[model samples]
Target: MRYLSVLLLSLLPLLAQAVEVGERLAPWTLLDQFDQAYSLDDQTRTLLVARGMDGAKLVKEALQDRPKGYLEARHTVFVADIQRMPALIAKMFAIPAMRDYNYRVLLDRDARVATRYAGAEDKVLWLQLDNGRLVAQQEYATAAALREALEKAPH
Candidate 1:
């Protein structure tokens, strides 16, 4: 019994960070590009969580050529890690440009949301969650590969 307890205790940290394919994501709320509140808990459609600035740019470029209707039809959200940026810089530059994005751009101010999905800050964390549960979590080295992965995901 003591050994079992020790094992369980050792696994606690991993459990906190683990977002397995069949499991539900940790509930989170974030401000969108328009400074409006958005929550993963409210989404009934597939939620896609991408990583940081580069990830966001890659996703934008990859979907740039797709039809507007098709892009609008997808339930995708980009999570940007803006924790390191100065407040003035974000307000002056980032926020305005973010407002122009055609799709929803969620701000992960503290990076807590991004850390819950994946550990890597630089790589694109392509997560597909249904209703709330994660269906797939893929890491891609390139934008084209990321787009291909999304295209092949079960709709």
Candidate 2:
């Protein structure tokens, strides 16, 4: 019983992670490094939410180059697949400082599924971004796809 209790306690926080695929997640609830809240409404122009480190890295690199009409300045959100093998992911996070790079780790229990959302394995993904009044929607092949699209979008 004691062992079961300890195990349950350890797993409780993991189970409580709020990220969900295809489910509408509020911008306000997403926690940043300091545990502060950022909402979609807070984004003045573009909001980039990538599922994996590669995607975020590429997008950040592209942003650094300052693509035309698409201001490099934007809200960047990163979601990590936390439920997978711990060592592999731990190394991934350790090598690159996610927080220092202006990226926020997404709290998702299903890392594999979240990877799919980040457009991992070359599969296309549908991203739903709610911009206060009008709903902005787009499909992305990879991180660059949506970044390019948002750069050209009127709103």
Candidate 3:
């Protein structure tokens, strides 16, 4: 029992260090607004995470005028954590509204994936990855700034 306890204690630090740069992110799959499953893989170059409604609005505004495949062309994925929203609201309004979006919105229903990365609640967290390994991270609080960054990012 003592050995087991010691082993578990040692693993705590590893669990706490979620989504760190210079490390590979564990692969995950989540359903999008259209109920299509998307998975993190080597081809995913950028991950845009929004933990709250404001952050999600930033992403929405940034992509409002863009074409349907804009993010996909850049090998980018946008994840929105909707776990805090009430189930009734999500089903009756949120998810339904999301279906009209031009770009894909990966829904983090339980926040399991979004919680792994650390960032401000109102800012969009941008994770730059190379073949599944984290290379850089940035946070955008403005839709214009996020739009500019996305435009400047390589395809």
Candidate 4:
């Protein structure tokens, strides 16, 4: 399958999902909703991927309240280019399920960190934070559909 190879190749460099969770997430700066810069690194205490969907919101809410339950809920990663995902990102964020959880839409900015973190084009990837360390990684596509699939996965 030529397409499959192309797709896998596209995801190669973005696959560095190791030790990023509790391993002091490398400092990354992104502009949040208020048009302000947000940075997360070793000094940070919390990092949330404010997903923009009711279903995802629910998961985030659960994680915030019943962190154990929420973390226990098996979830995977979804990735997409910022250009093709504004609506989906908005929809994913507007859900009451994630009322308190905050997230920044991963953008295709010109920076080495994101470039090394994400990969060619935009990709969806998941990280499993175990006791503050990233122990797992998963990537499906550049959209929410893949995240849905990961939610149902056996993990």
User: Best by TM-score, which number?
Assistant: 3
Candidate 4 regions off by >4 Å?
A: 1-23, 41-103, 106-108, 118-122, 130-132, 142-145, 149-155
Q: Which stretches in model 2 have alpha-carbon errors above 4 Å?
A: 1-28, 39-47, 65-81, 85-96, 103-136, 142-144, 153-155
Candidates' C-alpha lDDT: 0.70, 0.46, 0.93, 0.39
lDDT of 1 by residue, 22-127 (tens): 8877788899878898777635345545556676677777666665444335566667778777889999998888776666777888868876765455567767
Summarize candidate 2's per-residue lDDT along 79-107 as a digit string, tens digits.
44434437666557642454554445444
What would the TM-score be for candidate 1 when compared with the true structure? 0.75
Q: Write down the worst ten-residue block by lDDT for model 2.
A: 116-125
What is the C-alpha local distance difference test score of candidate 4?
A: 0.39
Pick the lDDT winner.
3
* TM-score winner, 1 or 4: 1
- Residue 39 lDDT in model 3? 92
CA displacement after TM-score superposition, residue 116 of candidate 3 (Å): 0.3
TM-scores of all candidate predictions against the true structure: 0.75, 0.44, 0.89, 0.37
lDDT of 3 at 34: 88
Question: For all the candidates, what are their Cα RMSDs to the real structure?
Answer: 6.2, 7.7, 5.2, 9.6
lDDT of 4 at 83: 30
